[model samples]
Target: MTTPSARVVLKPKRARPLFAGHPWVFAQSIARVEGSPEPGDEVEVVSHEGATVGRGLFNPSSAIRARLYRWDGGPLDDAFWKARLETAVQLRRDVLGLDARNSAYRLVFSEGDGLSGLTVDRYGSCLVALFSSLALHRRRDAILDALRELTGAEGIIARPDRAVAKEEGLDVGDVRIVGTIPEDLTVFENGLSYKVDVLQGQKTGFYCDQRENREAVARYCLGKRVLDLFCFTGGFALNAAKAGAASVRAVDSSAPALATARENARINEVANVEFEQGDVPKILERLKAAGERFDVVICDPPKYAGHARDLAPALGAYARLNHAAVDVLSPGGILATCSCSGLVDRATFRDVLANVAEHSRRPVQILEQRGQGPDHPVSAPCPETDYLKCLIARVG
Candidate 1:
């Protein structure tokens, strides 16, 4: 590797995790800096005893002061970025064959693919890239060039993750377009079609991570009354309806999302789904008051806890949602609930379910515990990459 601009020395006995493959080197773990390394600059990580741990990006303002992507002390050069992008694409195209079955899926999942702070999701012919690392953001030209060559994507849409930019003290601009991107883009999965608004929609226009969980939960929807809460683009509801559910009622607060979902239903000729635009919990209460019950209920919510501090409230919110879901579920019905908060681990999520069962006075049996699709592979060292949790349970 080229000589680093600076060297970060870790505190005593703090080098094990970085050596064992954890990618983060927090400010607290750092003892001193030999030279002034500006944010996004490549720096060598060293032990107090002068052992070189590796090299990584330095961001003093963030709690995760550094993000280590190289254990071999390789240079973060043009060739390095190209090779990383190629590996991510090859996993999806060759190893998983995700393109044969689905058009929209996560091509690169930041730390999951060993490229920290960069996430790329493919929406048909166009690719949406979100840069959370200043190093990668500053090197967008090279990143985009490598991606284009690797994926043959017509164009790229580089959007800013506002929250991340703020956390890292970055100056993120508006959306950038590299080449041609079609306005009317559609993605197919599990033989179902959905309209995607990559430019103005949420998180690259679709929830590509839930592609597999949608199918797994649909197995119990056949010949049943289904309720899909937070049904963004009606993924679960549409899958349930396609699986021969007797009827499907989907709810989401975003009108545009519901509109696109309705359009998706229309395109698929799905007549069993009824779209509703309103708060999910309030709608659940209304359904309970009307003496309505469903054989299956899906509660796939947004990320409630993005950080450690929000975990308590996130679990409480989950408990309340699950309790309400049980209120309208038929005896011995299925409840497919999910959480995309990386900070909320599986054990803590189970505790939330436990609280729901205790208060709702219903026995909740976990039928299956699933996660994001194969395309969104989890890096063993970075547990945060395994964020999406779909717990298929039978409530009795």
Candidate 2:
């Protein structure tokens, strides 16, 4: 018998999701490997019936055996990659008009932008590109070239996703810098200025995903005392303070992030925001004891669940923090809570909030449910891209 070459054959009935346009192919669903394929190599995916499903980057180290990029069985060459990159850029620039309003925004949202495992956020003239896949990381040079040409960026910084290094078998060492990067990079969002440290700051120097949410949540902050927990770089706090909030108190564990937030406040002349650095749970406990209350509270914490196994504990932690938030919330107060973990779906997080309502015995009325902004577009076929869950509710 002749060899079928390097390809991944799916088990019976496992091709449904791939056929449905889902990008990831789990190892468990794979029936067999027809040929030996190196990591980050282009390989075809086939069903048990010998029908060609698609072709994508094959990674044996990660649980996701393959991340298919094309459904029409196209080649993933440099031109193909550049076309995908251009499409992502066009969405932010032409479709969303993100650049016309804000200099800092998500340019490419990994799987959300059809480029699985790669995300590029523009921080003013400096562009920060994060590589989550070995295949994408290998093609950083070509990708950065396309990005620089498309955006006319002054500098490009290629950073590794250290969180996924172990799982994805990545080498997390140093960041590759191209072109000239300003020592002090600042970005504007919703009429607020923030100093971004692309080399040292959190998640590409800023959390641009919450840009719209900050503006939306601040509307309720006017003439109300607002508390922002896990307020990294004071995104929600500054917005609330600027929106005429009575006073804003923000808490975070990272001293560097708080320092940046304080600096942002200083530069923007926003003096109403007071930043406290400490563990959030302990701070929440202290606030409850102090009998402090706020009319509007924003809880935007870091990712609690990194994997499926951590989902239970993440839920427990969320329930604890939210219950504590409810403790400090006044009757009929607004609570803007958020979860960044993709594993914690909207339904599951809602279930947690339901439990919180039952335990605290408070009437929970959901005002609006939001997700990552349009810049972080969600692929309908890939629900995993829709990771963020923001719930603005009234707690009694």
lDDT by residue (tens digit), candidate 2, 1-396: 122258999999999889888999999999999889998888889999989898888899999999998878678888888999999988888889988999989998998888988989998888998888987888888899999999999999997787887788788775799999899888899999999998888778899999999999999999999999999998999999999999999999999999999999999999888899999889989999999999998999889999889999999999998999999999999999999999999999898789889999999999999999999998998888889999999998
Estimate TM-scores for all models. 0.97, 0.98
Residue 199, model 1: lDDT of: 82
Model 2 residue 63 lDDT score? 94
Error of 1 at 330 (Å): 0.7
Model 1, position 350, has a per-residue lDDT of 83
Per-candidate local distance difference test: 0.90, 0.90
For all predictions, the C-alpha RMSD in Å is 1.2, 1.9
In model 1, which regions exceed 4 Å deviation? none
* Model 2 weakest lDDT span, ten residues long: 1-10
lDDT of 1 at 169: 74
Off by over 4 Å in 2: 1-5
lDDT (10s digit) by residue, model 1, range 252-308: 999999999999999999999999999998999999999999999999999999888
How big is the positional error of residue 368 in model 1, measured in Å on the Cα after superposition?
Answer: 0.6
